[model samples]
Target: MSWHKHLDTSWFRSDYAAAAMPHDENGCVTGNYWLAWPPYITDDKSDPGSLDKILRRRFKTLEAAMAHVDKAWPLGEETT
Candidate 1:
């Protein structure tokens, strides 16, 4: 399998992916799932090129991790 599973991008950035879960020394999925994504970006008329996008999420199961992704990404049904 590839290292990353690419997904759609937001207006700010392109080339985004959930990244495959970390693997053990034996090359197996770990018990925990994790992801890092951008936070909400609010635009200000003064500075048109500024953003605060920092978020980290951890999940006990893959389902939970994907649920988080689903909530943030409701579009692109074909990939879903």
Candidate 2:
């Protein structure tokens, strides 16, 4: 099964942000799942261009990541 089957699209702010999740050759989930704000870029906090102001969190599973995003940002919350 594809890793994308695990995702809840409603939790994502946009497609660009959702693309942050890592995938293997078969397009199945590989590593950890992530939740982040707009203009989604690298998960590397050390990345010089990364937006520190935006909220970012990593989780072992997509469910955990979605929960974190819901708790931290919540539905109907305005994002940049």
Candidate 3:
């Protein structure tokens, strides 16, 4: 059986939301469930560059992605 799931990433849908691309266990890209935000100047006066400029991390399962997000950005926390 194949495990499939979808995650809601609308909360972080700013100009710096992380990209979430789903992939199968076999390492094949299934679909793009989330769209990354474009590049913009941050308040620190530093350009973090666009999402395209960085290597996007692919997740084989929604749980893995959720864990990564939680670790990177905890709930009820403000992000820059």
Candidate 4:
């Protein structure tokens, strides 16, 4: 019942570029996810499935990693 369990790690393989559009003028564009690691950090766009590697590499298991993230940052009230 953690965030990682709910994640489809397959989403992280290809890197993603920030939207070409600029962030809000206040720089308050919210509810976004970004790279905390590589392949992600690289100019090369991440493969959609590469995120699994990140979880496997960092948390040893998807559930543990996801739980940590959830504790640190719970989902928004309207998130679903």
Q: Lowest summed-lDDT stretch of 10 residues in model 3?
A: 1-10
The lDDT values for all models are 0.39, 0.46, 0.42, 0.31
What lDDT is obtained when candidate 1 is compared to the true structure?
Answer: 0.39
Top model by lDDT, which number? 2
Per-residue alpha-carbon lDDT of candidate 4 for residues 16-64, written as tens digits (9 for 90 to 100)? 2111111355555232332222322323335322455333334444344
TM-score between candidate 1 and the true structure = 0.36
Q: Write the per-residue lDDT of candidate 3 for residues 5-77, one digit (tens) a residue.
A: 3344222323233445544676565675533322232434243333443234545554565455556555445
Please provide, for model 2 over 32-62, each residue's C-alpha lDDT reduced to its tens digit, 9 standing for 90 to 100. 5554444334556765225663434455555
Compared with the true structure, model 3 gives a TM-score of 0.39
What is residue 23's positional error in candidate 2, in angstroms? 2.9
Q: Judged by TM-score relative to the true structure, which candidate is superior, 3 or 4?
A: 3
lDDT of 1 at 16: 41
- By lDDT rank, best first, the candidates go 2, 3, 1, 4
**Between 1 and 2, whose lDDT is larger?**
2
**Model 1 lDDT per residue over 6-66, tens place:** 3221112132434235556766655455443322333542321123222234555544555
lDDT score for candidate 2 against the true structure: 0.46
lDDT score, candidate 3, position 1: 14
The deviation in Å at residue 44 for candidate 2 is 13
Stretches of candidate 2 above 4 Å error?
1-20, 24-56
**Per-model TM values vs. the true structure:** 0.36, 0.40, 0.39, 0.28
Q: Model 1, which residues run further than 4 Å from truth?
A: 1-19, 23-31, 36-55, 77-80
